[model samples]
Target: MVKIRLKKFGAAKRPCYRIVVQDSRKPRDGTTIEEIGTYQPVTQEGENQFTVNEERAKYWISVGAQPTETVKKLFSKKNLNKK
Candidate 1:
């Protein structure tokens, strides 16, 4: 199955994540099918904490891509799961 999930990145104490599309069998940081956006929780409040390509996200979802729990919450915040 294909899934939308976060791929960990960044330094030891400072972590960021790329929201990517990958096969469910792949490792967490393994090859990704597509990178749809990013999330940097450590970034300051005023900065852009995360971003998502709405078109691609919708396309993936339409094609039956499932988002992980965390990713689902993020999408909900942006109203991306209303479809």
Candidate 2:
């Protein structure tokens, strides 16, 4: 099954992630179908986060891409409201 999930990257102490579309069975950082957006944690700046390409995100959902629990929460927080 296709899924929307996070692909972890960056240095050990400084972490960053790319939100991507990939096969569910693949590794988190393995081959991806497409990159939708990103997420970054900000300890220095309060409440710094965002999501992009909501239209594409919803398109993927319509075509049967599942989302991991964490991705689902992120979508909810962004108000994507995909089902």
Candidate 3:
């Protein structure tokens, strides 16, 4: 199955993540089909901690790409701002 998920990056204490489209069976940081955004968990909320292309994300989801729990929460936060 294809999925939309975070790929861990950055140094040990300062981890960052790249939200990407990849196969579910692949390793967490192995390879990605497309990069859609980023997230930094340690940063304050709304302090440039998350960045996602909503359009692409929606499209991928529509095509059956499952997002991780964290990614789902981020999208919800983004949508709340549009309301």
Candidate 4:
């Protein structure tokens, strides 16, 4: 199964994440099928915290890509929870 989830990155105390599409069997930071967006949880309020490619996200979800819990919330914020 394909999943839409966060890929961890950044320094020891600062974490950034990439919202990516990957196979369910793979490791968390393993090879991804596509990167549809990004998330920076530690960013300032005025700065953009996350971004999602609506078109691509819809396409992936349409094809049965399941978003993890956290990713689902992000989708809900953007009103992309169609499935």
Candidate 3 local Cα displacement, residue 3, angstroms: 0.7
lDDT of candidate 1 over 1-83, digit per residue (tens): 99999999999989999999999999999999999999999987699988999999999999999999999999998888855
- After superposition, which runs of candidate 4 have C-alpha atoms over 4 Å from their true positions? none
Question: What shift in Å separates residue 62 of candidate 3 from its native position after superposition?
Answer: 0.9
Candidates ranked, most accurate by lDDT first = 4, 1, 3, 2
Q: What overall lDDT goes with each candidate model? A: 0.95, 0.85, 0.86, 0.95
lDDT of 3 by residue, 1-83 (tens): 99888999999899999999999999999989999999888886558888888888878888888888877788888772221
Model 2: ten consecutive residues of lowest lDDT: 41-50
Q: Where's the lowest-lDDT run of ten residues in candidate 4?
A: 41-50
Q: Tell me the RMSD of model 3 versus the true structure.
A: 3.3
Better of 2 and 3 by TM-score: 2
Considering TM-score, which of the candidate structures 2 and 4 is the better prediction for this target? 4
Which lDDT value does model 1 have at 71? 98
lDDT of 2 by residue, 1-83 (tens): 99999999888877788899999899999999999998876446665665668988999998999888888888998777555
Better of 2 and 3 by lDDT: 3
Candidate 3: segments with Cα more than 4 A from true spot: 44-46, 80-83
Error of 4 at 83 (Å): 4.6
